[model samples]
Target: MSQPPQPPQPPNEPPQGGFGAPQDPPPGGFGAPTPPPADPFAKQPPAAPSTPPAGGYGSPPPPPPAGGYGSPPPPPAGGFGAPQGPPPGQPPQNPAYGYPQAPPPGQPPTQPGYGFPQGPPGQPGMPPQQGYGYPTAPMHPQYAAPQPGGGKKFSTQMQIIVAAVVAVLLIVGGGIVYSSSSGDDGGKQDEAASAGTDGGEGKGGEGGGLADGTEKAPADTKSKVGFQLPHPKVTDTTVVDGSWVTDKAYVKTGVNEIVGYDLAKGTKLWSIPLAGQVCAASRHMSKDYRTAIAFQEGKPSAADKYPSCNQVGALDLATGKLLWSKSVTSASNGDEPVRFNEVTLSGSTVAAGGTSGGAAFNLANGAELWKPKTDTNNCYDMGYGGGDALAVVRKCGSYDEPQLTIQALNPATGAPLSSYNMPAGVEYASIVSTKPLVVAADVGDTAGDGSSISDFFSIDAATGKLIVRISADADKYAADCGSTEVEKCTSLAVGNNRIYVPTEEHEGGGEYGDTNEIVAFDLTTGKLVGGRADAGDRYTLTPLRMDGSNLIAYKRPPYDKGGQIVSIDGSTFKETVLMVNPDDESVREAETSFSTNYAEFIYEKGRLFISEQMVSEPSKSSSLDDKQFLVVSFSTV
Candidate 1:
């Protein structure tokens, strides 16, 4: 439909004028009557001879006499040129002036009623009247009524619509901002959903809804919690080296000293000082934590003399008395005296492997069970897989291209279970075994110069069959590879269904900084299953024990900042840091150097007993004089 027309302007307003000026009226005045002129451009006709009618063949009737020539047109009626009056039944023109003027012979003059205002008579330059009649009253003022302040006012419905639109915009914009701000929180929620809540208190517990109809409150509101470590009594001052906790006692080794303490009261149970001064290398406790076997290296007598012999001693857990002691001939072959790096006890079998060779002894009487011939200069570590199965690695061949040959043997009979020849070019390597699976890590080409190659391999522990080999850049197969230029597995702690591997990365030419990470792998599927646990620079991780669904680890930061006990979920690999050493805080200066090492771990009931060392000294120490042994307990939440 078309819109309504706009109101007209007032009658007194003049017509707007612009670019073209209006022409003046003809030469005669506007009201003067004149005959129509003939067309100037019309064609002229030829002149014709004078002709007379037949009946009056003579010139036109003689012109009427001067006085008879229409009698001077009757003296022009009223005046020189006045108009005649209208005939009967006709109205006169110029009603306001009461002057009558003749109309056409038959038509009547229209009566003047309501029309446009005319200009006063005799006005010199007025425009002609328009054909349409004017309004009787001055247009009745078409504008709307003035508001209180003469401003436009919106209708009630329009105001409501505008308010609703603005509200919707605010709601949409707020949702976008909230989602962007909570992106990380959303990822945490996803992780929680997949891993399940099993660490903190009240996190997975049930709660009732409040009266306001909101759901149960969040668990973080419960309360904050802290931890404390049980103190161990210090007996005699000694250069403690190795320590391990059994069910009822703690055993510690020092240079020429081996001591045992009661778990309940911290009283000295017994001490076995060595005959010849020596440093303890490694120690192991039986599965029941009732017996311990320690390996010690004999000190050299003179610069030219080779170290005498390596010794392994068995001790009773409760009484701290020696069970048996045995000595093996040195396998040094003109090198420095050999030392063991790992000793393990399983049931009645005790096994030790070192730079000398790998050996298993009878736990009943300290009798040599098996001693393998040495082809390598060193055997860094060893692991026993139940009954008679033992896994060992020996470093052999040339110094430039050292080879680590992994072998599974019957410890009781010294018979080979299986064996595999590893690749050359690796300098250091370690092996771990779990009945059916064996994993080995080899680090090679320590001189850098672009010849470095580090790799990990998995083997069937039962049959010594190669399963898979993983490289440092094998993310899909081994996602926990270290980020350092030299990537190798540092420690292995195995649980019932999973294996925990801690790897290290050394930065800055392997001098100043180091980073540690722990990765959990599913033994059955051989797949990585959890997020990497990152322990910052200069920190090292050692697996302590794996109990039920949890794998406990000991983390050592640089320079004796003490140590912390970290609990990792076996399934998800989520970590909870717990039981940090409290005594380290009492040291006087921040620049002092300290060292703390986790010796062993024993988990019983709901408590964890950890044996460790607390050593503090200057950054440069002339002698090992400031080390102390400690045993502490941590309660599972």
Candidate 2:
């Protein structure tokens, strides 16, 4: 779930109470559902919102259909629960989830501004809603959990096992590409901080595209519901964080199984039962439709509810086969299989990292490539970021004064090609992109927004030298990285020799809502580029990933509209709408429910899939029958 809104307005902005300004929740909490509008088609059109003229590549959306968003789509099937269709000529009632209220008539909206409101004000004109807005406190790393109550002492061997397990938990979810070499570089370590005297002239690596290659845009961009998976009942919040798309199947992680569904019909294709819960899943998939995941060694028991995340494996996403599953003995930890916190794939190597150390395996057949070494300086490979290239964040020094070494490695040999030492006082650094060698970290904790990033370091991976350091004021850009997960950054895309990030949601040009835009920074000069894609009034645009060289972004809908997916040209920064969802009440409600902060969005081959990374029991305030989706797919075909 989203943490909460964060960051106060910049110093120059006026205090709250402007257009799209967050407002106090009505008598009930924001989660309170709002009734849908009646006769959606017959209802007279709302007065055009008084929005200031602005230049954006995307044209203002055409007026809503006079007959309502086409025919209300057929009622969703199976696990989607039977949502009643609207009566003929009547608009579907809004779902119980609240939506923003239109501004009081004739009141002018404030000019565009940045930052979030200070208190628990409802989203601009929005009513009580169940979920939160932005992040507040940092989220716990996947394995990092609080210690159990009533601490009991254990024997040395048991303590060692327990410590290794704790170390595993400290690992954040992985997406990092890690490449490691020997610990014998005193000279390279000293130059890490001061190395980049001038930004390199090179245009990073080939820009953003899928694991396979750029996807061709479909002929018809209009989308309709394909399928929806109902939430699985779980006693606790279960981690189900993996999803992959192949030609024949759309595979997803279940409680203890990997299930594949037919691309179009959503019919079950195949299922591979896992030994235990999935702990970490690599974002990278091989060209042959293979990917890696980390899971527990066994099922939860009363004695050990949270088992160690020790098993690492590769799966054939196309065939639903567990290609290989194995673990490694940590020479430094009493020969125990190193409990991994995260796992990632680079070329034929599957790399997993934890507190005890990091290990790499041959992706083809699970042969050991390298294992954690016994180091005297307390250095351990914390994690790696993989994709296009592999890089690792190695931690050394004492616990109180830790130092991090970033390395670009040879995927096959685990040999470092280049290394950069992070400056003093940076406890964590997240790899935003591997090939481009973009790293983000909040040096000295100044980012206050839990983004874990204040600056971005563009490095020449081939030379282990810095290219440019782009300072991202937390109050300006909406980009974020997992505080502990070295590769789990979002809200930005790296491609076309630049980094595209969304400007923080600010008061929009409209008289009622807020808006934002995606802007780029030159990877070579750390300077803003001229290209920008505006989200228009009341809409917010977030970079999802790169579509080959172009950028794919999701445009969040206003309270009364359906969401849209747009493709932004890499060089021109012009946007082309890929999919525009239906504005039917039930459909819009379902689409809006998945907050960009916590859900996973995958748009490929004319299909968009949104799934929750984790699921927990509904709050008491939520109705037992309140509909929840595990995975929801929309397709233009």
lDDT of each: 0.41, 0.67
Across 504-592, the per-residue lDDT of candidate 2 in tens digits comes to: 77544333555667778778877666546767766788999997788889887765667777777876665667777776666766676
In candidate 1 the C-alpha lDDT for residue 576 amounts to 54
Residue 127's C-alpha lDDT in candidate 2? Answer: 16
Q: List the residue pairs that clash in candidate 1.
A: 560-594, 560-595
TM-score of each: 0.49, 0.69
Model 2: residue 67 alpha-carbon error in angstroms = 44
- Assess the local accuracy of residue 570 in candidate 2 as a C-alpha lDDT between 0 and 100: 70
Over all chains combined, what TM-score does candidate 1 have?
A: 0.49
RMSD of each: 44.4, 25.2
Tens-place lDDT per residue, model 1, 1-637, is 0111211211332111010111111122112222221211111232553764333432112222334311111222442223345668988544222122223555543222122122236631122243464211111122222457664444332332223223222222111100011232211111101111111222321222222211222323221112212223333222234566665555665445666766554566777776533323233455544443434344434552223335666666656666787765444444433344345565677766555454677876888887666544544333333322455665566667666667676666757677766766555444444354455443553223221224446676566666655443222112221111111122456665556665433221112334445665555445454455544444555565564456666555443343445556665555555444332332211111211111334433323454433222222332233222244443332
Best by lDDT: 2
Error of 2 at 179 (Å): 36
* Worst window of 10 by summed lDDT in candidate 1: 15-24
Per model, state how many residue pairs clash: 2, 20
